[model samples]
Target chain A: MLDVRFSDVRLPSGPGVGYKPQHFNDILKNAFPVQWLEIHAENYMGDGGRPLAQLRHLSERFAISVHGVGLSIGGEGRLDPEHLARLKHLVGWLNPASFSEHLAWSTHDSHFYNDLLPLPYTDATLTRVADHIDAVQDAIGRRMLLENPSSYLAFEESTWSETDFLHELTRRTGCGLLLDVNNVFVSAINLGYSPQGYIDDYPLDMVGEIHLGGHDEDTDDHGAPLLIDSHGCEIVDPVWALLDYTLEKSGPKPLLVEWDTDVPDWQTLAAECTRAQAALAKVPA
Target chain B: MTTQSDFEGALLDANKPVPAGLSDGSGRPAGRRYWVYRNNVAVSLGDALGTGFPAISKLVGPQNFKNLAAIFLRQHPPKSPLMMHYGAEFPAFLEGFEPLKHLGYLGDVARIELAMRQSYHAADATAADPTQLQRLGEAELMTCRMTLAPAVHILRSAWPAASIWAFNMVPGSPKPQAKPEDTLITRPEFDPMPHVLPHGAADFLIALAKGATFEDALKVAQSNAADFDLGATLNLALGHGAISDILS
Candidate 1:
C-alpha cells in the first residue's frame, strides 16, 4: 500500500479553510490561524482572472490542496480527455499538497452534471473505477484521494459495501481516501446506517486528508429523516461528534472545513476552522 | 438507453422515469430518495445560472428565474465543469424561448451577461507602454495596428442593454431609456465591468480588434457616427488598459 505521507500529499496536520474570494483579504491581512488553503479545482480553471491571481498569491503562503468535483472517476463512460488534461495541467502547476476527487460520478454521455451521483458497487464497476483511477493517477503523475460520497439513495445491484468498494479501489490503484466525516453522518441518516460503523470499516490507514462540510436536513416522501449535503450551513452537533470520533482513531489528518454555498463571513469561517482545530487537539498523538 | 444513460436522462428530465434497480435502503424503490439528486442537480445548476447571468435572473425576479432555469437545465445541461463558464447558450435560448420573447430585451440582457463572463475569462495580456505610441510621429501612429487587450469586448444591441443591466444592479437608479445601445467591456485589472459606448465606439473597437490600424478604425468609427469623439474613446481604452500593442 502507498503510504499516505509518502504519496503526493504533504499536507500540514491542522485545520484548513476552503479559500473563498470574499475572504482572501481577511486571510492575508489578519493572517488567520489557517495551516493551509483548500479550493475547488474547477473554479481556477479559467485562463485568467482575479480568482487565478488570488490563488497564485495564496499558494505562496499556504499549502494548496486541490479538490476536484468533476473528474467523473466513477462514471460509466471513459473519462473526458479534455477534463483530464485540465486536471493534469493544474496539478502540474500547483503540485498541491493533496489532490482529490469523489468516488461518485458526475458526468454521463458527455453531459456534465454539477452534482455527484451515486454508482452501484459490483465487480464490473470495480474494474471500471480502478481503471479510471489508474488513468487519473498516471495522467496527473500523482496519487489522488477518492472521497466517499454523501448518498441519499443506494443501488440494489450493489454487491460491495461502500467501505469495501473504497478499500478495494485503493488497494487496486494505490490511491488514497479523503474520508469526509460529514458525508458519513449525512449518508448514514439518509440511507439507514451507523456513521461510526461506516468510519470503523473505512480504510483509515490510507487516508491522506479529511473533509468536514455542512448539510441541510429534511424528510423524504415517507416523512423519514433526510439530509442533503448542501454545504450551506454551519457544522451540526452530530457531524462534529462524528469528526471527533474519527479523529480519535485516525489521529490527525489534514482536516478541512468546507462551506461552499451561502458562504459565511471570514470570522465565521475561521471559527469553524478553530472548532475543527479544537477537535483535532483531542486526538491522541 | 443504456442503464447509465437512462439514469442520467431521467435525472435531467423530470418526466422520465427513474432508472431500474435503485433503492432507498429501506426496502423500497429509490424514486423518492432519487429526488435528492434531481433536486441537487436543479438547485446547483439554477445557482450557476443565477451567478452566470445575475442581471437576467434579477430582471425576471428570483422565483421566475429559477423556474425558467429548471426548464433551461432540462434542455441544456452544462457541457463543462466550470460553473462560472456554464450557460454559454443561455442568451440564445432566451431569444428563441416562446414565453420570454415578449420581453425581447431579455435576450439582449442575457447577451450582455454572457459577454461579461466571456470578458472576465479572457486571456491575460499586458497593456502597451504609452511611450511606444508617444514615440511615433503622427503619420506612423495613424498607421499603427493597435492590438487590444484580450479582455476588451464589444457588445452592440438593439435594446438599451447597459442601462437595463446597470439600473437593476443599482437600486433607485434612473429608469433605462428605450433605445438601441452599444457597450464596451474592459478588465483593467480584476473584475470585468461594462461601459456605455458612444454611437460609434463599438465600430472603432471592433475595427481595432480585427487588426485595423488607428486610421482605419477612426474611418470606420467616423462612418458610423460623424460626431464620434476619438479623444474620449482613446482615453477610455487607454485608461482601462484595453490596448496591448501598437504594431506600426
Candidate 2:
C-alpha cells in the first residue's frame, strides 16, 4: 500500500478564519496562534504583488494550505493545460503544507464559469474524475485533496452514493479527501439524507483536511428545503455540531473556517478560530 | 455513459428546457435542477470578475458592475479556468461600452488596473545588475541594447490614471482632477507597483519594450518631449527594476 499519511497536517483545535489582505498589518504585528491560514490559490497566482508578499510572509509564520476554487478538475472535455500549469507553478512556488480543490466542475468546452457545479456520481463520472485527479497530481508533482461539494439537488442518474464515489475516486487516483463536513450536512439536509449516517460511512482514513462554513436555508418553489453553501456568514450552530461529530469519527484533521462573503474583522475571525481550536481539543487526537 | 460532448452540452446551456445530455432515473425532465446549476454558473463568474477587478467594481457601483459583467461574460467568457486572469478584455469592453462612454476615463482607469494586474502576474525575472552599466563606456552605454523585463508594463492614457487609482485606493484622498497622464506598472518583487511616469517616459519605455537600443529609445523619448531627461528616465526604470539585461 502507498504510504499516504496526513500526520504532517496541523489543524486548528477550534475555528480558524480565512486570511484577508485587510488584516495584513495586524497579522504581521501580532503573533496570533491561529491554527492555520487557508488562501484561495487563484488570488495569489501573481508572480509578485502584495498578495504574494503577504502570503509568503505568513506561510513562514503559520501552517498554510492552498484552497483552489478554479481548477475545474471535474469539468468536461480535456483538462485545461494552462490552468494545470498555473496550479503546478503555485505548488512549486508555495510548497504549501496541503492543497485542495472541489469535486464540482466549473468549466465547459473552453469557457470557464468559475463556479463549482454539481456532477452526477456514476461509474463513468468516477473514471473521468480519477483521470483528472491523476493528471493534476502528475502536473503538480504532489497529491491533491478533493473536497465534496454542497449540492442543492441530486440527479437521478447518479448510480453511487456521494461517499462511495469519493472513496472510489481516492482509491483510484491516490488523492486524499478534504471532507467538508458543512457540505455533507448541507447536502444531506437538502437531498433528504441522514447527515450522521453519511458521516459514519465516510472514508475517514482518506480525510486530510476539514472545512467548516455557513450556508443559506430556503425552501424551493415546491416547498422542498434547499440549502446553499453561501460561505457568506459564520458557521451556524448545526454545522458546528456536525463538524464536532465528524471530528469525533475522523480524529483530528486540519479544519478551515471559510467565510468568503461579508468578511468580518480579523479578530472576529480569530475568535471563530479559537472556537474551532476548542472543538478540536475536545477530540482525542 | 456520459461522453465529453454530452457533458459539454449540459454545462453550456443550462436553460435548455429539456437538456439533451442529462437525465434523471425516471424518464422525467430535470429542468428545475438546471436552474440551480445556471444560477451557480452566473453568480460565480460575476463574482470572479468582481473580485479580480475591485477597482472596476467600485468605479461602477455593484449593480452596474453586475450588468456589465453579465454582458461581458456572454461576449468574452473566460478562456482559462484561472479566475485571476479571467477579465483581460474587460477594459477593451469598457472602451466600446455605450453606457460607459460618458466616463471617458473609466476605460483608461480599467486599463491601468489591468496593466497593474498583468505586471503582478507576469513571470519573475532578476533585474539586470546595475554594475553592468558601469562596465560600458559612455558611448557604449548610450548604444547598448537593453532588455526590459517582461514584468514591466507602460500604459499611456489621456486621464491621470495613476493619480485616480491612488485616490481610489487611499481613503479620504482627494478626487484626482482630470488631467492626461501616462502610467508605469512594474513588479520588481512579488506585488505590482503603479507610479505616474514623467512626460516622455511612456514613449521611451514603449521603444525599449519594442527592442530598441538605449540611444534609439532616448531619441523617441526626446522627440515625444524635448525636455525628456535621460537621467530621470533611467532612474525611473532602474527604480522599478524594469531593466533586466544589457548588451553592447
Q: How well does each candidate reproduce the native contacts, as fnat?
A: 0.78, 0.49
Q: Give the per-residue lDDT of model 1 (tens digit) for A72-191.
A: 888998999998999888887777888899988888878888999888888999999999999999998878899999988888878899999999999999999999889999999988
In terms of lDDT, the poorest run of 10 residues in model 2 chain A is A3-12
lDDT for each residue of candidate 2 in A65-179, tens digit (9 for 90 to 100) = 8888888887767787877888888877677778889998877767777678778888888888899999998888778899999876666667899999999998899999988
Q: Going through the candidates in order, what is the number of backbone clashes in each?
A: 0, 12
**Pairs with steric clashes in candidate 1:** none
Candidate 2: stretches off by over 4 Å: A1-17, A28-33, B1-33, B54-60, B123-137, B158-180, B187-193, B244-248
DockQ of each: 0.63, 0.44
How far off is residue A91 in model 2, in Å? Answer: 2.4
Best by DockQ: 1
Q: Highest lDDT among the candidates is held by which one?
A: 1
